[model samples]
Target: MSTPTGFMEYQRELPADRDPLERIKDWQEFHKHFSDEQLKTQGARCMDCGTPYCHTGIELAGSVSGCPVNNLIPEWNNLIYRGLWREALDRLHKTNNFPEFTGRVCPAPCEGSCTVGLIGDAVTIKTIEQAIIDRGFDEGWVVPQPPKVRTGKRVAVVGSGPAGMATAAQLNKAGHTVTVYERADRIGGLLTYGIPTMKLEKHVVQRRVDLMEAEGIEFVTNTEIGKDITANELVENFDAVVLCGGSTRARDVQMEGRDLNGVHMAMDYLNGTIKSYLDSNLEDGNYISAKDKNVIVIGGGDTGSDCVATALRHGCKSVTQFGTHAKAPLERDSINNPWPQFPNVYTLDYAHEEAKALFGEDPRAFSVLTKKFVGDGNGNLKELHTVQIERTVDETGRKIYSEIPGTEKVWPADLVFIAVGFEGPETPIIEQLGLAQDKRSNVKARYGKYVTSVDKVFAAGDMRRGQSLVVWAINEGREAAREVDKYLMGASMLP
Candidate 1:
């Protein structure tokens, strides 16, 4: 360890974000960075336990526990503590293909499993991680180093999200000709549209895409497999194929008056706003606007949070989010949620902070169930009806939600965005390839061995495992590339 008493000597600290009220006026990343000395002090807090759980990368209690990409947490922390940023950046890149993206947007399960968090706050792993990569970019340490030789093999990766990008990067490193197909007009699938600029700027994604392009990975946008090009043609044109199309098909709420004109899917709103913002700085009026409207977001996940933030930027009059589950506790429930498992705790995320700054309180309503959407006489959404619910366990151990009598209420809602989550991958590609599906309708490809029933065809990321973290998607992509390399050359050198 760099400092034996570092964990005890320092308390956890994070860089201050831009003032919430001020940042809401425009679309820019809000997070600030720490000074070099401050970062070194923060890095010294790593405990470097004999059994480091931070990089175990396992699922516990149905939630991710550590860095799913298995990033070498301790090594980089120590390097940063010793004032070796380039070395720390090198160590960080050993596992993750894109640290800048994850550092900005990842939930950082690594900190949750940190040994220091057992008694105190976890080390500032995420901050230090972002710092290392950002420094690398500024210092020109990160550059394209293409393979010197070609293997005379070709691979086609469908989808240009994190998973597809990682898969293409690794396979190209093995000297194979790689082509990535993105259905959207731009690369970076969900990264380009699903995420708003405040969290991750679009240029960060485009920068990586540029580096990958320079490394000889072909990216073909505005072309969708099974439509613009047949699946059979892709299979015939390439030596092998890997499907990284994420789980789309947003899960929707089935309720009365569902056909209102003001009701829309969360992705549609986010995608449109981001596209317009990038295209013309929101001057095009091509996206759904929440100005002077009462917006209600129906889900409590990250997507819902983004919707809330986006609405605030659009000068919405008021906003509220609904969740079916109870509010999380202030601290971890040791009995139900123990060490190493991700803690289900309550804290104000960025959007919540912004909303509180403007609205005087948090905007989430927990344990509330929506009963129906009440529309205006002309079929535009006007309000929503809901009832409070309580949880109970039956004799058979099944969970049930019982509606409380006298708790029915109605709230004005000019626009409603459903962010309930996704069901699975879209059907067109799956059906065209005649791929087998699991019970969840995800592609039936085993975890480590990403082989499908069809020969020379593989699957990874959300399409294979359903909606999950981007870090896990990177993990699957890297492993799938290894397997594909083995299949092609009768052996593999990828890790």
Candidate 2:
């Protein structure tokens, strides 16, 4: 257990972030490093609650309340407080295969459910989690521990994102021959391109890929399952196959003028920038430049937030974001979204904070809807016709998006990005594999048992469960690996 009076003796202090004004000028990470002592102090804040709900990994009101990977939060925290870095890393790795990635990108529900959060600020769970893994890497404690003997059962994993990586890692550890296929030019499906470099630097992702490659995992990039390589070939060649293709079909806007030249989907724009930035920072002529242009991002979620930040860095003249629902409150609403569950509170993420500092105000305009895109005669986006919306709960307790009266507004836009979220996994792979799909178009796979309708095949991650956090993907991937192992060897010794 941690020190009894630790919570009272210390306050939660996170790593300091760079000034927004300066950070927006480049694509480097914003946060400065925190010393081991400071992180240890924060880790000690973990209370000795009889039930440390932080690691429960349970679903409440349709959202997760704790660590989805079921990380031994308190155990690691106590170890960190005692300066047992290796022990903490061991505990962390027991549950999650990729703490470094989650530590950076995960929107930590664990922190939201911390017991300390009830009275004061939550423990710096994310910071401590990152610190542990970072120290492990720096100390050269993290390295490939390949299986002593190979199971000789070949496994094909489709997609190289979090789910596929986790599945490959766990299965390979169980001594299975695993090969991951990625359609993109590089490995790491979304991690390589979907996410901005500023949010999660490319090198951090590549480091893990490099490590995985060294551990006997075969990674085939620029190879689509259904296109470059036939689905039938993969199914027949491998003893078992797992589909971890993440949801990539962008949810599109059906309004008029949406096909204009300056209008683009968030992922397309983000991926293009990633490809171009690495090559020549738009000198490659493949990236859509937002420089000196009025930019409008439709959506206020993480994807939209990323779009805003990317545009600002590209030197966009102005940035404005519109959400289809009411603006979130500045703090937690105890009545609707209580503690222990991931609170649906309106919190300013890094991008919003930077935008506020640079633009003199938050770039978000909530409860707003884009009625249509207005394009110039030559097929370039010119402006956005928008309206405000009112959110009300119906008698059935379902929230309804109703348009507010007389709130039509016109906003100039040189470039527009639609970040409404993903619909489901792309249809080509599903069609090629002849896999059944749920109502939401996600691949139909039973939870806990990741078996798809097809025999000797499995599915996990966003492809199985729709858009979710990286932790859930890790959880699903681990669970799927256990099932796969059982299928391959008729029993699984994996946790």
Number of the top-ranking candidate, with lDDT as the measure: 1
lDDT of each: 0.94, 0.90
**Model 2 pairs whose backbones collide:** none
lDDT (10s digit) by residue, model 2, range 247-355: 9888998989989989999988889988998778667779888999999999888899999999988988999988887777778889888898787877788888888
Candidate 1 per-residue lDDT, tens place, 1-495, comes to 879999999989999999999999999999999999999899889878899999999999899998999999999989988999899998999999999999999999999999898888988989999999999999999999899999999999999999999999999999999999999989998888898999999999999999999999999999989899998899999999999999989999888988999999999999999999988999999999999999999999999999999999999999999999899999999899988898899989899999999999999999999999998899899999999999999999899999999999999999999999999999888898899999999999999999998988999999999999889989999999999999999999999
Worst 10 residues of 1 by lDDT: 188-197
| RMSD after CA superposition, every candidate | 0.8, 1.1
* Estimated TM-score for each candidate: 0.99, 0.98
Task: Score candidate 2 by TM-score against the native.
Answer: 0.98
How far residue 87's Cα lies from its native spot in candidate 1, in Å, is 0.8
Model 1 ranges off by over 4 Å: none
**Candidate 1 clashes between residue pairs 3 or more apart in a chain or in different chains:** none
The true-versus-predicted C-alpha distance at residue 437 of model 2, in Å, is 1.3
